[model samples]
Target: MPEVFTAYVRIVDGFNRRVGRIVMYGIFVLMGILLYSSMSKTMFLPAHWTLEMAQFVMAGYYLLGGAYSLQLDSHVRMDLLYGRWSPKTKAVVDVVTILMLFVYLFFLLYGGVSSTAYALQYSETSYSSWSPYMAPVKIVMVIGIALMFLQATSILIKDIAVAIGRPLP
Candidate 1:
């Protein structure tokens, strides 16, 4: 592979690693906040924003973790047949499958970007008592999908190189 392409893949991997760790770390914060909110509500001093805050954090956690999951090959899949395939065969299958996934991701990323823009434009908020701004959440969705696609592209490149006679860097 070219030096530039190698650098790009390494950068994508590093980005996912950093994002994954940050999101993982935030889970502790989420837990603490949730506990506080539950206790407050039990004591008749409800933190109305807590539930919504948790939702935002959880959504971000899952979305941002997607690329990391893919990178680590930890994403859920029914791999009964796939597990039996040889490495080159797996690469071939992955190449085709990643193309199909990209088709879906294109629409999701497009919608996410458009929705995020709309939210930002209108300063949209959820229709709830705690109605925090929706832009930040929507922005996370856009960013997450984009990152997944980026990771997928990196994987696809490596798969292609391996599927062929070339050795991957």
Candidate 2:
């Protein structure tokens, strides 16, 4: 692989790793929120925001962790044939599939950005009791999707290198 492609993979991988590690702690935040909700309901006036906040945190956790999961190859796959394939064969197949992933991510990112814009422009709020502004979560979603897209691109580069018998380290 060329220096530029190798550098791009390194940078994207490093950034996604850092983001994933930081986002992992969000699970604890979610647990704390749920705990507080339970305590408040029994001992005091229930907070109106707990459920929605938990949902937002969970969405952040899942979406933000996606690229890291991909990096680790931890996402579920139908390994019926994949596990038996040789390394180069796997790389060849991955390149093709990752192209499809790019298309999906492109559409997802476009919609996320559009929805985020609408949220910001209209000051959109959830139709709930707490009625929190939607922009913050929407922004997080966009960031997560963009990160996943970058990570997918990095994977594609690496796969291409492998397929060409010039694998990057």
Candidate 3:
């Protein structure tokens, strides 16, 4: 069972990492497009709108990259106390952190859904020419939070395996 679970985590983490990389590339392309639009007089929209699009893309990029960041162990952490812990102690701390993250993400998902619903109910739109519905962005927040939560679960499972004297399959 541990082997199967570990294999599943590896596969999912790989897939998410690839998806995150694609998202990052898309962000770069979007930035280039925005920059081109800004520099070209032929473009109808104002420069501010292009800036807004860049901001939107950046937000998406961060959200989508979160799971991959966790998989890579690249997320920022304060090591002031954690660095002193033994391997087993570190595993325990990791489990605790994962639980906290799970709870936080649960709330974030709930809040995101609520916000999106409200936006949809009120027919929210951008204050500029684009007039994009805000609900879509809010929905993406839910997806991002959910993905982060899943990544936390994967880490927690690995930590548990280590704590139990397993080789992580």
What lDDT score belongs to each candidate, Candidate 1 first?
0.89, 0.95, 0.78
Assess candidate 2 and give its lDDT: 0.95
The numbered model that scores best in lDDT is 2
For each candidate, what TM-score against the reference?
0.94, 0.98, 0.83
Minimal lDDT window, size 10, model 2: 68-77
Evaluate model 3: give its TM-score.
Answer: 0.83
Error of 2 at 85 (Å): 0.6
**Candidate 1 lDDT, tens digit per residue, 80-143?**
9999998999999989999998998899999999999999999999999988999999999889
Off by over 4 Å in 1: none
Give candidate 2's error at residue 55 in angstroms: 0.4
Residue pairs in candidate 2 whose N, alpha carbon or C atoms collide under 3 angstroms: none
As a TM-score, model 1 comes out at 0.94
- Compose the digit string of candidate 3's lDDT tens values, residues 51-120: 6666677777788778888888888999999889888889988888888888888888888889889998
